[model samples]
Target: MLSDIRPAIVSTILFTVLLGLVYPLAITGVAKLAFPYQAEGSLVRDSAGHVVGSALLAQPFAKDEYLHPRPSAAGNGYDPTSSGGSNYGPLSADLAKRIKGDAAALRQSTGHVQIPDDAITTSASGLDPDISPQYALLQVDRIAKARGAAADEVRALIQRNIQSPLFGFIGQPRVNVLMTNRALDLALPKGQPKRA
Candidate 1:
């Protein structure tokens, strides 16, 4: 009995240290060294060297000039740390109400009555970094108008910035909201411009 208890205790202690502390530290160290940018949270910076946000998570943009990410059920929209979907089932009345409210608000904000499902629905993780291409395009008119840029020019920029699905078929096509907004800032005419 004594021998059995002693070996069990020793093995448990050894495995805990090896798996819990040592293994995690080793992997983290290797990842930091090999993939510094990603290991550091894949943060994006502006030309002025200001930290904007991480490429991994989406941020909320209420202004019509910026493309908005999917509606987040987290704290305020797009709260990364509080990542989670609303978890409302299809027949849930709360889901219906939220979608209706979102669609109405989007129409009012952009003055574009056509709302995509992506615009009205939240992603499962609540940290989706991309919006459907259609949703991104919906904002082009509003943003172009706000910036006094031609719709065609904004459309071109959106096209240029669009990223295809991983492996060309894994997930749906999406446009990164942060990248699109940053490009908009840079793509608008430098001097006086004509509005469409």
Candidate 2:
């Protein structure tokens, strides 16, 4: 019995060290060495070299001058640590109410009677970093007017910033919210600083 227990304990310790510790460390090391930028969270920077945000999560922008991300089911909106969906069933009254409220808010803010569902709906992961291209275009007018820039210019900026789907088909095309906003800031008209 003593011999049996000793071998079992020793094997458990060895497996834990190898599988739990060594394997993870090795994988992490290789990832860092091969893809340092991605392994470090894909942080974005501003023209001033200040770290602004990550490409992985959305950031809220309630003002009219900036394009907005998809509605987040996270706390308040876009809370990274609280990443999750609203969990409302398709037939849930609560979901309907929320969508209606969001639509109304978008209409009021942008003065556009027709609101895209993507503008008001939260993605399943609650960390969506993109809006539908239609949704982004819809806000172009409002954002351009608010920023006192030509609509065409803003549209051009959006077009330039659009990211294609991974491997051409794995997922939908997306605009990384933080990267887009950073570009906006960098491309701001000579006199104006990009507003938050």
lDDT of each: 0.83, 0.81
State, as a TM-score between 0 and 1, how close model 2 is to the true structure.
0.86
Consecutive 10-residue window with the lowest summed lDDT within model 2: 187-196
List clashing residue pairs in candidate 1: none
Q: In candidate 1, where is summed lDDT lowest over 10 consecutive residues?
A: 187-196
Model 2, global lDDT? 0.81
lDDT of 1 by residue, 6-121 (tens): 88999999999999999999999999999999998999886666778988888887766778889888766678778898999989999989888888888987778778888889
Over the stretch 16-98, how does candidate 2's per-residue lDDT look in tens digits? 99999999999899999999989988877766777777888788877777788998898767887888899899999999999
How does residue 79 of candidate 1 score in lDDT? 83
The alpha-carbon RMSD values of the candidates against the true structure, listed in the order shown, are: 3.6, 2.5
Query: Each model's TM-score?
Result: 0.88, 0.86
Best by lDDT: 1
Give residue 40's lDDT in candidate 2 (0 to 100): 85
